[model samples]
Target: MSALRIEGYVIVSADGMLANAKHVMPDSLRFKGDQEFFNAALDRTGLIVHGRHSFEGQPNSPKRKRLILTSKTAALAADPSNPNAVLWNPAGATFDEACDCAGVRSGTVAIIGGPEVFAMFLDRYDTFWLSQAPHVRLPGGQPCLPGVPERSPQAILAAHGLKPGEPQILDASHDVSVTPWRRAG
Candidate 1:
């Protein structure tokens, strides 16, 4: 079997915030370009992994095959409501075990986020697609990664051995751009 490759997808404000102080993703961070790009990438993934908030924030989330990371679960457990989802506690079970429980044998695993989930896979991502809304800034907002406001996302990626690629303009009207950060050799 092929190794399971992990990829991350996130959009942040100029200040590196994924959500406001209330832990809500604001409309300011939403862009047509970013949404389209994100949807396309996620559609190809064998499985999606994220926190509860991230799952709910997404549209049509129940239709996707995913693992919802949550402390409420002791380990990997099937979601009663959604047959396509699994509830997982990282501390209770290994990621590989979670994948087995989720029935995703091997393929790209898309790691979408709520900060902690993003941080957990820092060392595992084959490519992290970092999209930015450069004009939006959220003070006292929830960071995309744990160290934001103290450290820039670029710095955090570099520290984890990821290198940024050329950013492509996704939305010229909103100045939304996406840069793919790949694991450095």
Candidate 2:
């Protein structure tokens, strides 16, 4: 069987901007407990799927299989150094097929994102790991899951048949929360 997971590190303001899309990292925003959470997530993931922007944002790494989902013609040429990187266009192959080809299988296939990618696989994902920043602000930026209505994350997850599973508060330093959700039936 195939398994899909949607995971993201998001920081949203009260008004709801996830983070600055233009900047490498958002302005005045810290990762909080992201390092530890991300490390754990990576350990469970067999393959990492991400948008071109998210792929580019990553620092150099030789480990893990990274797939970039894009419709661009010059996709591979854009990142020649990373030979392990593969460009997957949904037009050519569905996300599931690509993950299978990359040996994702029953193991976790983490779909990291830039909104559109999250939207595409929302219905298909069986798990979602969300890093919720309690008190943070990004004045002018894109939302973690744009086009998703102004509702609490719990409400949104419930609507999608995903219920919170394990939640760990990352201390009180950054006021961030890490929660994992599983699809219900």
Clashes of each: 0, 0
lDDT of 2 by residue, 1-185 (tens): 54454554444444445556473445445564665667667666777777877742434345677778878743232236565667777877766666665666667767777677766766666777776666765555676665543765556667778788887776468666667777788
TM-score of 2: 0.79
* Model 1 C-alpha lDDT per residue in residues 11-88, reported as the tens digit of each score: 999999999999999888889889889988887888999998886345755678999999998998889988999999
Candidate 2 wrongly placed segments (more than 4 Å)? 1-16, 21-24, 56-60, 74-79
What local lDDT score does residue 172 receive in model 2, on the 0 to 100 scale? 65
Number of clashing pairs, model 1?
0
Question: CA lDDT of each candidate?
Answer: 0.91, 0.63
Q: Highest lDDT: give the candidate number.
A: 1
Q: Could you estimate the TM-score for every candidate?
A: 0.96, 0.79
